[model samples]
Target: MTTALHLAKSDDLPKLSALVAAFHAESGIEISDEARTNGLAPLLNGIPHGAAYLLGPARAPVGYVIVSFGWSVEFGGMDGFVDELYLRPAVRGRGIATEVLLALPKALAEAGMKAIHLEVAADNATAQSLYERTGFRTRDGYRLMTRVL
Candidate 1:
């Protein structure tokens, strides 16, 4: 059996950091310790006000998901962004990630969120398929652009 772990407190930082670092490494995204530390501060503080959850056995975290809040006039109210999701390679094929994706919207709705969004790399067909299977569809009308300043 699998369990869902809700990380709603500052105490969850270490586990979250480890999981994110593992994900970055596995995905070939080079990140520094300081970057990871700085990046996790908001999630740890629960600032920008969001939640992180883990899926696996109760004591060990095999995967994690981070959700953040935002306003979307198009959705007619507050929406959620799935900021990050990562499951260990060994555990990838077991449908756990699919379960987490399915469950997150319900959890967010309970918190009064109206919608959820995520961005997967254009070439990442595996992830796109999973998202589509879970009710997320691509928006063809707009292009996602970003600038680092």
Candidate 2:
């Protein structure tokens, strides 16, 4: 089925949250309900400096993408992070994701964003391929390291 993407509204939070939780579970990442409740709620509601979108038919939201904005000197201006991008497993293999990635940058650019970025699991070849096809290249000199707060 072909799905269209739209700016996510507050009413779509429950479905978006479920999809996020499922993605977390499938990836072995533990996401607390409190985080979803307290954190995501505000972000999706426009209380934060970011945006989220839902992708699916008009009747339902089957996937979502969350983006956060930031300054990037390297990119010469504002940049964005694709904090999340997910399509239900049943909807994979179709070109929906590719189309989304292809279209998103134009929208972001029009909003004054200079670049967009996303992190994928090193072993996720499928995701890597999709990203590469969309013009994302691995930075040769950088390693992503993080410490939990």
Candidate 3:
């Protein structure tokens, strides 16, 4: 599977949304379709805080990745978080996701992003290994805490 990242556009909403819904369902996230669409639209519209990418063919993407930018004083100026990443089950076990993880950050770095981060569930050893191989290390003692507003 190719790991080329195609920046998603406004017109790609329908397909992207469906993939997101499927991914969320598979991951057991219970967000409503309306909520997901509402959240994704602005990013597709080129919002500065975040961006979405369609992996492989744009028309029938094999996977998707969404990144949200922020200012992290600790990491320096601009930083980004891998808000989501999803590849079709049939396409897993390949190095496609690794390719994206390795390649995308260089592009982002050139664009002035200082750091990149992601969150993986504690029990998901496969994902943890993959992330570790790609240079994402657990920050010693830090944990990701969040508040839904």
| lDDT at position 127, candidate 2 | 96
What is the TM-score ranking, best to worst?
Answer: 3, 2, 1
lDDT of 3 by residue, 1-149 (tens): 25678999999999899999989999999999899999999999988999999998867898899999999898789999999999999999889999999998889999999999999999999999999998889988899999988
Mark the regions of model 3 whose C-alpha exceeds 4 Å error after superposition: none
Range of the 10 consecutive residues with the lowest summed lDDT in candidate 3: 1-10
Write down the TM-score for model 1. Answer: 0.90
TM-score, cand. 3 vs. native: 0.97
Better of 1 and 2 by TM-score: 2
Model 3 residue pairs with clashes: none
Q: List the candidates' TM-scores in order.
A: 0.90, 0.92, 0.97
Compared with the true structure, what per-residue lDDT tens digits does model 1 show for residues 42-133? 77676875777777764678988888889999888889889889998888988888888888888778878999999999999999999999
Better of 2 and 3 by TM-score: 3
User: Model 2 over residues 65-122: C-alpha lDDT tens digits?
Assistant: 8898899999899999999898889989888899889888888999899999889888
Winner on lDDT between 2 and 3 is: 3
lDDT, residue 79, candidate 2 = 95
